[model samples]
Target: MRDYLIKATAFDGQIRAYAVQSTFLVEEARRRHDTWATASAALGRTMTIATMMGAMLKGDDKLTVKLEGGGPTGPIVADAGANGQVRGYITHPQVDFDLNDKGKLDVARAVGTTGSLSVVKDLGLKEHFTGQVPIVSGEVSEDFTYYFATSEQVPSAVGAGVLVNPDHTILAAGGFILQLMPGATEEIIELLEKSLEKIPPISSLIQQGKTPEDILNLLLGAENLKILETMPVEFSCSCSLDRIKDAIRGLGNEEIEQMIKEDNGADATCHFCNEHYHLTAAELDQLRQNGELQ
Candidate 1:
């Protein structure tokens, strides 16, 4: 099915939950970046969770997640907006390795045990909000879990998984986030923890064709969950030729002249989408005139 995300609350609103089925979106990303199995898993997981977080924002608000783990993959960057859009890329997308001890992708090894996961949120305010925490496991999910608990001071449980096909495409990709609200009793917390442990991996469930609703039913029980909102999610990038052209103009007339005089043309590629933008000599002249007007 098409990728989507669900927002819900359970146990009489003591617990807030979000889950998504992101196979299609992940496949698109894998195809775009040509990521290897392990790298695909890592990037897909981050993108999945970032999508969910984006849904938490108000209109025009957005956030960026940056993970620098000091591993072979270098860093991963993801951006999400209130409009249910997400895009991400890893600094190195061709890294792969054998399974971990748990027979899962070796994400921790590939992401490294050092470095940090940082987030910058633009809430339509004069100053953006920034939160950061050291990488707890280098597994994307646990690192986000730690970020919520430490950086945001919200007790949360996060699980993200991505299974890759032998051909390097995405087999499955998904995740869930559970947060405890104030006055949540210990009894409910224990029960939810047990339920999470009993369920299969998020990727396995999505691979089996489970919907986001089905995932919430398994974790929070069909009888208890109160569905709040459902939003379609996908791989979307806001970068475009116009935006790149504006950036080139922002470099001022002298830089544009230097490029036109020496390089003959300009090439710009977006980090998030890898979409290349080429500026011809004529385009550079136009940009130079615009810069002079500025």
Candidate 2:
């Protein structure tokens, strides 16, 4: 099935929640980046959480998430729009490591335990929202949990995971975020805490072919859960040849002339999607004469 996300509320609107199934999206990222096992797990986890965070926004608003753990994987950069579209890349996508003591992917080792997780939101009106927290754990999930409690000052329970096949492709990927809204009673919080303890790992559920609603039912139960909105999610990039061409033009006519004289053409690649765009010498000449990229 295609990837999708669901937004819901529980306990008479005292609790807000989101759940997502992101298998194909994460797999697409793994294929595009050629990420190894541990790298795949870390990147997938970040992308999963970032996608859910994107669902929290309104129209035309977007957010950027950065995981600079100072490990071999370098920094993980992801951007998501309110429409459930997300794209990201790890600076070093080839990093890998052996399983940890729990026999899980060694994401912490690959991601490092130092540095921080920072989020910047473009909310329009010449204003932006920023929140950052020191990395308490290199594991992506706990780091985000800390971010919620400290940076955003929201009492939230976050869980995200990605399972990689033997060949390093993503087998399953998913996550959930449960947030406490105003007037949440102590009883409601306690109930959610206990319920979370009894559920299986999110990745395990996704691997077993569970939907977002099934996962939400496991987290918040069906009786009190009210599904609000559901939207499709994917690994989508906003880069194109025309955009790259404009960037080349912005480098000024001298740069374009040099490219024509030395390399015969220019080949540019996007950091987010790794898509390549080439400009031939003839094209460069046209751009040089046109003044503005067409």
Candidate 3:
């Protein structure tokens, strides 16, 4: 099935929930970065959660999630737009290790048990919103769960999983986020805690052909779920040749001339999608002239 996200409310709006199928996007990331199994799991899980978090915004709002665990996988950065578009990259993509005792990818080892997860949200305002919290677990999902509760002051359950194949491709990737609204009753909270314990790993469900809607229904009873919106999600990057040119222009005429003289051109690469942009000597000259005009 095509990658998508489902937004819903349960228990009469006391619970806000989101679920996403992110296999295609995760695979795209793995292909671009050539990440190994453990690194792929770390990157995939972060991107999966970022996609759902993006759905929480409106209009032209955007957010960036930075996870630095000081592990072999290094730092991970994910950018998401309100329109269900997300792109991410890992500082080190070639890190892998044997499966953990749970028979799962050793994400915690790859991500480390220290460091922090910071989120910066641009709400189209003068100042951006930022929140951060120490990593409680190197596992992406638990770290995010802690981030929401400690940084945002919202009680939440976050679950994201990526199953990597022996060939280093993504087998499955998916996730869910459930938050309790104000005035949530203790009875409902207890019920949710119990349900969370029994729910299967999100990636396993996706591999079994479960839709985002079906995942939510299984987490929060179908009878209590009220579907809000469905949005398509994908791996998208905002970098382009024009933007690269603009950045080079901002460096001023002296820098532009130096690039043309020393290197014969300028090369730019986007970390998010691994897209490369080359500016010919002629193009660099034009940008210098454009800078003079401005």
Candidate 4:
């Protein structure tokens, strides 16, 4: 099935929940970055959580998630917007390691345990909102849980998982976020905690053909959840040749001339999607005339 996320409320809105199946979306990212198994899990989990967090925003509002774990996988950065657009990259996509003791990808080893998880949100205000917390666990989900509790001051449970095939492809990817709203009753919290402890890994559920709604039912109970909206999600990048050209122009005329004389042409590559753009000598000359090749 096509990837999508569900927003819902349970127990009369005292509990806010989100669940998403992001297999296709994460697969696209892995294909673009050529990430190894461990790196794929780390990056995929970050993307899954970021996409759900983006859903919390309104039009034109967006957020960037940075995971600087100081591990072999290096730093991971992801951007998500309310429009369901998300793009991300790992500083070291080729990193990999043997499965952990639990017979799962060693994400913590690849993601490292030292550093911080920071988020910057553009809420359409003069100043963006920023929050950060120490990385309590290199496992992406627990780190995000710590982030919400410490940074946002909201009690939350975050779970994300990605399973990779032997051929370095994505087998499954997805996650769930549960937040306790104001005045959440103790009984509801206890019920949720119990449910969380018993459910299978999110990735496994997605692999078994579970939809976002099905995930919510597994977590919050089918009868208790009130489905609100379903939004399509995917891997999307905003970078383009035009944007790259604009950036190149900002370098000034002398730099453009240097590229033309020394290199004959210019090549630019995007970090998010790894897309390469070539600027021919003729195009550079036109840009110089238009005062955009600087």
Number of backbone-clashing residue pairs for each candidate, in the order shown: 0, 0, 0, 2
For residues 144-200, what per-residue lDDT tens digits would candidate 2 score against the true structure?
999998988889999999999998888999999999997899999999999899989
TM of each candidate vs. truth: 0.97, 0.98, 0.97, 0.98
lDDT for each residue of candidate 1 in 1-294, tens digit (9 for 90 to 100): 799999999999999999999898889888889899999998999999999989889899999999999999989999999888999999999999999898989999889889999999999999999999999899989999999999999999998889888899888989999999999999999999899889999999998999899998999899999999999999999999888888888899999999999999899988888888898888899888873322
| Poorest stretch of ten by lDDT in candidate 4 | 285-294
Residue 51 of model 4: what lDDT? 97
lDDT of 4: 0.93
> In angstroms, how far off is 90's CA in candidate 2?
0.5
Off by over 4 Å in 4: 291-294
Runs off by more than 4 Å, candidate 2: 291-294
**Cα displacement (Å) at residue 46, model 2:** 0.3
Worst 10 residues of 2 by lDDT: 285-294
Instruction: For residues 44-128, write the lDDT of model 4, one tens digit per residue.
Output: 9999999999998999999999999889988999999987889999999998998899998899999999999999999999999
lDDT of each: 0.92, 0.93, 0.93, 0.93
- Please list the residue runs of candidate 3 whose C-alpha ends up more than 4 Å from where it truly belongs after superposition: 291-294
Q: Highest lDDT among the candidates is held by which one? A: 3
Which candidate do you rate higher for lDDT, 1 or 2?
2
